[model samples]
Target: MHIVITGANRGIGKTLAGRYRAQGHDVTGTARDGSAEVVLDVTDTGHHADMAAQLGDQPVDLLICNAGVYLDKAERIDGYPAEMWAQTFAANVTGVFLTVQSLLPNLRASQGKIAILSSQMASHTRAPGGSYIYRASKAAALNLGRNLAADLRGDGIAVGIYHPGWVQTDMGGAAAAITVDEAADGLVDRFAALSLDTSGCFETYEGQPHDY
Candidate 1:
């Protein structure tokens, strides 16, 4: 399978890229710093265009929209700045949409599946008052994935939104519950299980359905 993973320089994206490559799949790992096969800053339209052009006619069997930001983490109620919200939304919500749009042709050629790494924090039921920007952006991403699933089903494309668990990554912190390998392993299985019949599902890395 030809897989495309954004934000692959580090964290879960990096681990997922390595795992897929170790499995002998063709993996295009993209990073903003050009540390991977492709250079992409998810919020940049030019980068998205360049990435699409570089792939040409190659079919992308899987597109993982793993790039995101959590700018307002732990911000006090009055500390949430407007710019933080803008940046967070740009990366977490608009970026996912742009990546999917840019790769639509390639995905269509392969009848691919899209896996969006959202978070349990995106669920309304999980709201705990912190990281408002991150939570809102992820929720928007979930909504985007669901609608994309509906629109792309006719093209044999499936979309699934996932909560990758509390992973031990730069974003998730070392104290987080799961190791990168555990999260990646479970996510790989979840990605493989995604199909038109189960498209638009919001699920955990462990393959359990999550509340919307």
Candidate 2:
């Protein structure tokens, strides 16, 4: 199986890449700093184009849209600047869309699946009020993945939006509830279980259905 993962330089993405490689699967990991097999700043369409060109018709069995930002984590209710919202949305929402769009042909070729790593914060049921930008962006990403599943189902592509758990990563922080390996392992199973029948599902890393 050929897997493509964005933001694979660290955190859960890196763990997933390592796990897949250990299982003897072909993995293409992308990072903005060129540390991985492909250099991709997901917010950049030109980078997406370059990535697609580099892959050049390689069938992608799984495309993991894991690149995202949580810039307003420390911001107060009155502190989130407009530029911060723009930057966060650009990375967390638009970036996901562009990656999927650019890789559409590859996904179609392989009849692959898409796994979007949104957050539980994206859920309307879990509104704790802080990190508004991140929450809204993730919600948009969830919506994007759901609609993409509908549109791509005819082409034999399945899309599943997932909350990768409160993981102990830089973004999730050291106090997070789960280890990176735990999140990655659960997510790998969730990704494997995704099908057209469950394409538009919003699920947790542990494979439980999440409220939209």
Task: Report the lDDT tens digits of candidate 2 across residue range 1-212.
Answer: 99999999999999999999999999999999999999999999999999999999999999999988889989997799999999999999999999999998999999999999999999999997898999999999999999999899999999999999999999999999999999999999999999999999999999999999
How many pairs of residues collide in each model? 0, 0
- Local error of candidate 1 at residue 52 (angstroms): 0.8
Model 2 ranges off by over 4 Å: none
User: Over the stretch 1-212, how does candidate 1's per-residue lDDT look in tens digits?
Assistant: 99999999998999999999999999999999999999999999999999999999999999999998887767998899989999999999999999999999999999999999999999999987888888999999999999999999999999999999999988998899999999999999999999999999999999899999
Candidate 2's displacement at residue 82, Å, is 0.4
Residue-level error in angstroms, candidate 2, position 110: 0.6
Error of 1 at 31 (Å): 0.5
